[model samples]
Target: MWGRSVPSAHRTGRWDTGGVASCFGSTVEQTASPGRKRGQPGACWDQTGANGTKRVADCRHESHTSHQTRLPQRSRTGPARETPAINHSGIKRSFTAWRASRRGKGLDIGRPPEHDLRSIMNAILYVDRTGIPWRYLPHDFAPWETVYGYFAAWQKEGVFDQLNGLLRRLVRETEGRHGEPSACVLDAQSVKTSSNVPAAGQGIDAGKKIAGRKRHIGVDTLGLLLAVWVTAASVSDNAGGMHLMSHIAATHPRVTKAWADTGYRTKAIEHGARLGIDVEVVQREPGTKGFKVIPRRWVVERTFGWFMHHRRLARDYETHPHRSEAMIHIAMIDLISRRLTRESTPNWRDT
Candidate 1:
């Protein structure tokens, strides 16, 4: 009976090697032992062969086993942090603070309007520092047209002349309390222009080869810009001498002596006599003297150098001479600012 029952069980294909009951397909191996439940999903077993050799087998479903081998999913966070906006007003306030720290005794003109003054001054400084054309100013600041308009308005209103006068008075008062300047330097520089403005025939000097305008600058012993005048470029340096000396006398009453090159020899002496300034020419040696440079008179040369640093001043581009003159004043203000702040670092290295 036991042999008949075993044959019936085998005939049912429960133990055939090529059937579903084969070792590869059957679940019998998982439930053969009464004490063991099908081990939780991915169980492994150690089986002993009849000769006592051991082998390891996995009881896991193929899908579950493959799923366990994959990498973990990642989170989706964004990119890097950004910087904050600049406080331009705060920067201007800081500059004003620095200006206040260095301010000496003077008439109180309570601070200028924040935006307008700052923008205008910035435009001037930009022109002087970068030596760029006014029309080419960057858009972040005031438009070039606006700045130039304000400059022209100020010139028409005599704002620059007034400011210069005020600075001169302050210096003169200080000098009066101390002593007179030893010597003043006089010189005229010509700015070639395509300007079509008409001026008096007396204002035109044919000798300078300049037909449009001239700027005569006078500097004191300390190389401070004392006075400036704008006239037809045809105006002779001698012709402009009297007016420059008059301006100096009016601005700096205590100037004792003046110096110039041969250009200012004739009329300068006459004007200096009236103003009580002894005019002396820095003489050049005779012969083909390979461009003999004069001392003391170089202060005006230095002033011209300062103006030439601005491209607009390098060539007059304005339709009006007064506009060009206003730009020159702006240049002077920039020079004063740089000198006072000790910010005159050269932008290029000598090559």
Candidate 2:
């Protein structure tokens, strides 16, 4: 059995040392005279010296009053900790201006917003940059659920798509090119999916031996995104190309020619022609052994490389392919906004 005088535990703040002291936390207490006033005699703990002499050590004393009255002590050992905050560098003034103008012109009659839309947009950029789960969002921004709610509503409403398309035109015009391209490069990439991705939304690419989904994209000579389509990996290039042409025709009908690899040679060309696009297949030379740069084809490949810079696009994690496509647009929006506004590159390493 232990001695009755064995330290039961110590008190902290206004908490007494007893049955529930351990649950509150192990604390060091100071001895005060019974005649001293409450505020005059602060709590302190006894420390043993090297010579085994008992000495009183000072401790911050907090009363049972409200939290506002308590002040935390400063330590010389290290800097004080703070909740992490998302960076605002990813947001551009021009982008915000465009959004405000668009919102004012189209829909300004809704009830007042509970949260700032800019905060939600920054939260999304933070998530896309860090590739973190929605639940793990930092406490500084709006709640993750609220941010995701805005993202889903905007995605379904094609808000990002419209913004990206407008920015692409503005960027092209600034570069002394036509706002609408007469020619584009077509390409498809197979991205593996996460384990949580459902089979109904993804399939295996037999040629690439990748079990995932395929993203077929059309980009102008400047490597800016023009159109995008997502499909199961099992869909052949020709089949996916046909679907993508319809989208391009509807969205970017000014594209009269599309440069592609040999995989989209015959039927793909015929289908594109029927949709009023001349599909030019860039075939590899027969004598080439290893590396050969095909003309115009590398532009689309380079655009895909740009997409790879975003960690969220490295794999298909969304359960719905449409959501995955929306994520790609979100990534492209960040890229294009920076290009158009000369904004500094976002510091993703902070998180």
Candidate 3:
């Protein structure tokens, strides 16, 4: 009635303001009733106080802050600075060399890529190392779809496979070994998968007690990947070993001997003999207890340890077996490329 009139509550439990309601059930008096300014209106802020109770106070004037006032744009004194591309110089160099020296180089005819190839590679590696979804890729890189398209295309075309081989050869030579390994180690790692992976693509691993997929891979003594085969976790070790041996035979013919854990015994050994690779089983010492590393088989085991260094390999996320295998190849490609170029990979320990 004077400075500010508090709304009167009626029998119906509604606050009476003649006819209108605004901030909440309490209505603001539009026309000035007494000493209050024109813009001031009673409000219930729709928020809790520090003590966690609602407080209704006398009308206060506040700005809507919805662009009603014009803001001046800052005047630029120099050209805008672009963000540096994510590609490491080593990765860029390795990919460039592979593209130039690889067979069928003439087939690269096209309108040329809209995004930088190095940038594309950086994006792919980002997803692998971070274990993020394709859509969650950082905005600084190419659009997720474009980057994934390039990944899918390159993976389907065996680009990663070839790149892995090139990097393997370079790393082997750097270690004073021949480009092609005459002996190798074989192993499998079973990991759980995301819910999006269908039951058709997943199976329970009775041995490791993991439910998802298994990665069977062959690697040289230097711990570089030679071949990878992805299968449902339920698949027998012998089956995975057979497929892995076949892949290695087709790709690395010079391999004459292989070492495996006891899991790959008769069928796998027989298959390797048929393919001309003498498979030898590396057994643990009779009375050993905890985590003793066996001879020869330790190389493939070390390769799996390297896989855990990349977060994506901690679990199987791909919908297809082939794409899952490609992820392993991509991990090795990133590792070997950096190793050959003497580039250090960054980790959480970096300041």
lDDT of each: 0.65, 0.77, 0.80
Show where candidate 3 strays beyond 4 Å: 1-112, 346-351
Q: Is candidate 1 or candidate 3 better by TM-score?
A: 3
lDDT string for model 3 (1-351, tens) is: 222343442232433232233333554554423333433454423235788644353233222221223345669855565654667888779877876765356676766567877789999999998899999998899999999999999999999999999989988888888999999898888899988888999999998898899888888998899988898999988998899889899888999999988899799999999999999998888999989878888777888888888888898889889999889999999888878766786566663
lDDT of candidate 1 at residue 342, scale 0 to 100 = 44
TM-score of 1: 0.59
Each prediction's RMSD over C-alphas, in Å, is: 21.2, 8.9, 13.0
Q: Cα RMSD (Å) between model 3 and the true structure?
A: 13.0
lDDT of 2 by residue, 10-52 (tens): 4233322321223355443323433334344333334457876
Stretches of candidate 2 off by over 4 Å are 1-112, 344-351
- Model 3 pairs in collision: none
lDDT of 1 by residue, 1-351 (tens): 122233333354422222122325654434322334543222233345897634233324432344444546677555543555779899989987876665544565687434456678688668755656678889877888788777768889978766655554455455563334556898887766643444442144467555556888887765667777777676677878888888778767778788888988676798789888888888776664565457887777887887877776776566666666677777776666555444664455521
Shift in Å, residue 169, candidate 3: 0.8
Regions of candidate 1 where Cα sits further than 4 Å from its true position: 1-116, 128-135, 162-182, 195-211
The better-scoring model by TM-score among 1 and 2 is: 2
